[model samples]
Target: MADELVFSVEGPTATAARQISLAEAGFTERAHLQEWIIQNPQVLGEGVLIVTFEFDRWRNATGTAERDRLDVLGIDRNGTLVVAELKRGAAPDTVEMQAIKYAAMASRFSVQLLAEAHSSYLSRSGASVSADQALELLRTHTGYTVDNATFRRPRIVLVAESYPPIVTATAVWLGEMGVPVNLVRVQAYELVGTAEPTRLVSVSQLYPVPEVESFMVGPRSRGDSEQDVGPELPEIEWSESDYAKLRALPPKPTVQAILDLCSASPDTAIGLRVIEAAAGRTVFGARGELAGLTMLVKGRFKRRNWPFSVEWGATNGVNQAHYRMSAEQAERWISSAGNLEESPTSRLRSQEINDFGSPVSPAPHKESGVTPQ
Candidate 1:
């Protein structure tokens, strides 16, 4: 057992201390810890982006009649696949080798394969998401595209409450040789008090100490002759005139309101609903659907002969149409549009629909004093 965590009240004088024994923590059970990690993956620490867990079960290629399961599969900020294995108690001596085998199998995964796996994971959770949607979410969350070259090599992470001396030494040696393997020790502690029970867990990286120099291995080949690079999507580029037109458009009330909200703070993430609500009314008139808005925006951009295009794609978790404009272009458009002063009743109806979270509501043009064309 590891050392127990002690908690004491912070005061001028030391009060009675509450000792939390690791042995008494229920998370010491392997299954419990696994579930906890699955539910709260941030416990793995920063930079780890969880794509899916219990990714899949596979057997060795040699027909050895042995099969294994990967506890958690994800990608890091560097776009490298991460194979994480979890154990509540002391990790076995062969844990490093086990993780290596898992990584060897996982390294062959392409962006499509990962997207499919993630889609399945989401389906099991009752989310009817497609593989493309999952891939888009992955890109948004990690800010790393799955098709990046770094994903060609996979990394291994071993997580346990404790690692035996032999396991630590082997991990150190492997890391020194550039095997991209890491060890994380996770332990739970209970904060006992007169009120209710509270538990705290700590995750610490143990191998390849930050201060120590260690050899890191280059990307490993998946032994496949053909690489699946997935789709080659085109990047959107906006011309100076396109920026000017988008900024100078006579701001309709709906568009102005959205711009005001978005431009109020430079750091706020523009929500999908805000964009959808604004685009629905401003671009396609108050009665527009997402599909219609997509066509209208695309058509408008095309008619202008702009260098950029408005394409419909999955963003965050929803499918919507957005311009392929640079951040600066988008900011300028929002800020400049905010300067316009107009508040039409049709725009108020659009805002009401957005505020009420009802996308199917009929536009109240008649009641809003706007004659239906």
Candidate 2:
């Protein structure tokens, strides 16, 4: 694989930093890589909860320990168990088969078993989360029951610097055969004149390129497979109970501002700069952090299926992703989250949200020139 480049900007000058191997950079699979993923699991998927790492609780029919430890195990917003295998460098050829075995073993876990493991993991991390509490946390974060028929199988995610051709081929074949597999590349780069530690770690999805597949016309029926993504997901309706849950959350000033801005124009997608200006600060984190916000909200009592949808497009030659809230949810969110009356959001009411590349609407957008993030 060709080495990737990371540039450092000093004033108007840009310096390209050479990409180094994991060993050269003093990183190991278990210590550095696994810990980063556990701390921030959005690298794999939005709203994925870390159940446990180095998991080897599986037992054979004879009650013998299987003695196999998966690197990291998590669950996404849809309650599908995520089996993520980590590698600091390029993955060996046998990695795919190894991940498949770990996934198969994890698929046998029930809601009870999964909660117990999560609780244990939490305790080890000095967080002391009980099994019952863990189960409730799972329900609130995912908004889907783990015991449902949909979570019968676990999904697979491979994280490495690079992968062999055979491994990528197997991943594609598995996806075609209805297996949910994601291949991610985690890059490590050292920048010049940054801080005490000038290292920069970036995670990106290699397979199933999302930026290319902006929209897909597909079936709407809910399927058992996690890979069955419909053309467009319906806006999640928030109930009184859901509103109460939102109110229970700690003061999220940024989220509150977003609700007010989107609620102002109802059914219109707003620019990130306008949202940021409304909030009076840079609200969302990097791409992974932004995914946790727009795609799925995750934290203590984080709400799943947030009514926000982010669409990527070009603005003045720069590509930016914008967030939108439907009219129904906009009204619901503002009322539930407390009323905040601001200036009307400057947005065009587009007829075609699916065809984002086309001109937004007949009406001009006052906020379009606000410079999206």
Predicted model with the maximum lDDT: 2
Candidate 1 runs further than 4 Å off: 1-5, 8-23, 28-31, 59-66, 191-199, 212-373
Residues 198-282 of candidate 1 have per-residue lDDT tens digits of 6667677887576532344345468722222222222345444554575466544434434444444333334334555545454
Deviation of model 2 at 241, angstroms: 17
TM-score of each: 0.55, 0.59
The RMSD of every model to the true structure, in order and in angstroms, is 15.9, 18.5
Candidates' lDDT values, in order? Answer: 0.56, 0.66
- Highest TM-score model number: 2
lDDT of 1 at 18: 45
Task: Give the distance in Å from residue 368's predicted Cα in candidate 2 to where it truly belongs.
Answer: 58
**In model 2, where is the ten-residue run with the lowest total lDDT?**
364-373
lDDT of 1 at 286: 31
TM-score of 1: 0.55
On a 0 to 100 scale, what is the lDDT of residue 138 in model 2?
Answer: 63
Scanning candidate 1 in windows of ten residues, the lowest lDDT window is 364-373
